[model samples]
Target: MSTSRAPPVFLLVLLPFFASTAFISSVNGAAHMTPETSAICPTCPYFLPTPREVTTPEGIPANLTCGVRLLADRKVSWIRRKDLHVLTTGDFTYTTANKFRALHLPGSPYWSLQVEKPTVDDSGIYECQVSTQPKIFRRFTLNVVVPSAAITGTREMFMKAGSDINITCIVKGAIRGAPVTWYHVLPRPPYTEEEVEEINAGGRGGVQVVTDKHAGTSWLLVTHATWRDAGNYTCAPVHATPATVSVHVLDEEVPAGLHHDLHPSEGRSSITSPPCSTLLTVLLLVLQRVAAVNEHGHWCSFCLLLGITSCLSLTAVYTAAGETWTAAQDLSSTWSVWRL
Candidate 1:
């Protein structure tokens, strides 16, 4: 006999132990929202619309922007959490540094920090705070990357009092903000980097304040370089680490170097020559050989002259003799070369 029985509730207590369990959810349990749930798009867990990523400024007068979704009300007070620096409180804006200015856009929820051509000392952190449900505060790590003083273009010199030589100091990119100061070392380099650097790069060497593409690039076009322009040149690619380049001008530094003399390892990418000398020499030799052959073949010239004279004489005789022969033909029988 089989007995059907429902298990006791106490006995079913073991059921939980036998069943599989899910993982423990973290504090942020709201997972990503799929597009299928279009209505919840705005309130999606991962729907934080962060501001665009901005690179470190290489110069002064930088713009830092913060995004706010109609939430950062007048109660907006900026408090930097990283360093615990209270930036703004109530309607009062406080900044010890005179260069910082906060600008609130009209009709837009974007506030920006306009840093007045800041310097290496002005680099720091900035926080954008908005009084919202979660008190939305964006922390932006601000850094002013002073560009490395790398070579931009060089000033190479070769002059015959009025010959041109190009020395290009090729640097990476124009660094906005700081002005590039060009300095030159007189006499020669002192076998040291510190010796090459000048106290005021902008003072000497015909101050070329690069107003154009200052951060990444700049060029000095020197026409007809002379003996006075040869020295160790400097390119302050970054104001902090002003780079230096040396240009030596030679009176004989022109484009009049031999093609074959170019070192194979020179890495110069060019191949060109007029080939006038070689072509002229070959033509002269051919003309001379032709003239020599003509001199050696005097008999050929004489033969050609004789043939022409003989042809003329034969033609003359044919015209004159033909008439007489025609008449004589009646008297006698005759055949001539011209008639044949």
Candidate 2:
């Protein structure tokens, strides 16, 4: 009995395999029953609920971040809500655009989508999705701003001498009242080095800047403008593109199609030629001189010389007054009078 009958050969052969199977089953059951083991087991992937919001200026890089907890072996992806296009997944970019890329560090729970040189068109909502049985997601907002600075009026300005130069600079998409700096670039010789001077408010006589912080506008005023003030004026604002305007200061006459306000001090002096009546009077005087020459033949040479001299003087006056056609007409009439 103690020795028992010799165990069957098949039972002896299968005993080790049965013991191993029972041992494995018991270990697995114990693992499930242990609280510490259950607590340490991997959990389902879920979003950490840390919402991200980003705003970046145009041409700058924008980062949209997403935080996830317990994201074990799950793929994270970024999708643009505007077009529903998949942007990035697990550090790999799906779009053909090179500006977009996914950023993730080793052993980090945060995933970020970076957009280089972002523009205003890139602003919109983005979704960060995690691969799970039901699929979890977190939404984020990205706003791209395009800051700009420009002068209010035309690029080229014609200002008269002794008139005031008033220029306005407006800033858009700025976070707050942007500080503006004015620069003056004087006209220089072709081969000479350019000279740029920084303009300060209240630093010189009749030159000052008025800023409206609330309106994000700055006004540059140069009282009693002269020929020396004619050049290029630039308005540079912080975090915005600079704008320039060319200024031309005329001596007395304003060109045609120019604004009357250019010469505020001298009220609208746009005339370039004398009146028709004055020209007619000059013509009659020349004719009268010719008649005198014809009447007195004794003083022929002296009277003819006087008539020629009077006609030539009138022609010179017409030419100097910017009336070239009138000058030519007067010369023709005088020749006719002399021939008569």
Candidate 3:
């Protein structure tokens, strides 16, 4: 049976391998291995190869291309994580970014996503959706975390004293709602030490938040950003395992303490109280340089940084309603974009 594939459709189909625990797959003797691991199919698993983080070799542009050449009888589609907007399907394309385009290797069994000059706005969980009688699917997280002098969370500013300094937590993996709290690492008299609690003219709860998902890009929104709001903010999700980003909002915009720390574009690092993915995983992969692995036998840093990471070599497992695959991970490094 010649298992090849037609042009791929964007369906936000995620390969369950990466989102879950690390699963090891031994690579066979093949030259064009999309990733370190190949599909365990006698025929073809036309999923794409995705890397957590790739230090583009200088001139090398950023793109997420599935390094496979397979024939899949199923159809594919891509949806926006925010509004569930279908970007591409079969021969149709709908994104405004000209840098974005799909392809099919003639005589080859592979499909890929090509982003021209990927920007921060281009980070999110992209589902490689496949549809069939009883479909088989996979996932890839295209982490377009371009280097920034000030790499903060999604960034949202609000009123301060008059409003609740809402600090939200960014989630990773599958954590829906964990724990959302605020920390004053700066100078605080302690929760009780404050003899005078300034009453905000808002509502009963000074600050309240609304979480969406754990994959889309999000950051805390301080109702009123001010010198008093300057401090460390964190949101811990139900996953509990550790996946949060400490957003340091300064009164005068101080440099992030952990200047060298890398933040994930999607849930690759932190989870929100809930809500956020589809293209490109719609997330970013934070590469932590930990000294050693932990007792759980998992990488220590994944848990330490309040961010948990599971290593997988692209094990295709689609769990969504309508999704499929081609060799892909997530994060567009090979994709090309000229930027506006």
TM-score of each: 0.42, 0.49, 0.28
TM-score-wise, the better of 1 and 3 is 1
In terms of TM-score, which candidate is stronger, 1 or 2?
Answer: 2
Writing each residue's lDDT as its tens digit, candidate 1 over 1-340 gives 9999999998588544322111112232222334543342343222234443344545656666765543424455555445676666433558686666677756665567666766656566666655433344556655666556555444343345555434344454234554555665554323434334442434434433343554355555444655445556766655456566555555333242322122222423333322323333344444445656686656554553454344445445544533222223311221232122
Q: All candidates' lDDT scores?
A: 0.47, 0.72, 0.39
lDDT at 300, model 1 = 52
Top candidate when judged by lDDT against the true structure: 2
* Model 2 accuracy (lDDT, Cα): 0.72
Report the lDDT tens digits of candidate 2 across residue range 1-340. Answer: 3776898999889765543332123222111113332243335444444546887778877788887766779899999989999999998999999999999998998999999998889999998887754465777888888777889989999987899999999988664666888999875544557688998864568999888867879899999987667779998877778899999888755443332334444442453554433444455566567767676654655654665566567667756655554556655665565465
lDDT of 3 at 329: 30
Candidate 3, residues 1-340: lDDT per residue as tens digits? 8988854443224444432212223221122323333443223344445452332211224554444334456555655555666666554677776766766555554555666665556666555555532333444455544221121445533233334454444444322333333223332433423222222235333344455654422344455544445444444333223232333333243234322121112223332212111322222221222332325425443442232122111212331212333223322221221010
Off by over 4 Å in 2: 1-45, 49-51, 150-170, 174-181, 187-195, 200-232, 244-340
Q: Residue 121 in model 3: shift from native, Å? A: 1.6
Rank all candidate structures by their TM-score, best first, as comma-separated numbers. 2, 1, 3
Candidate closest to the true structure, highest TM-score: 2
| Residue 284 accuracy (lDDT) in model 1 | 42
Clashes of 1: 23
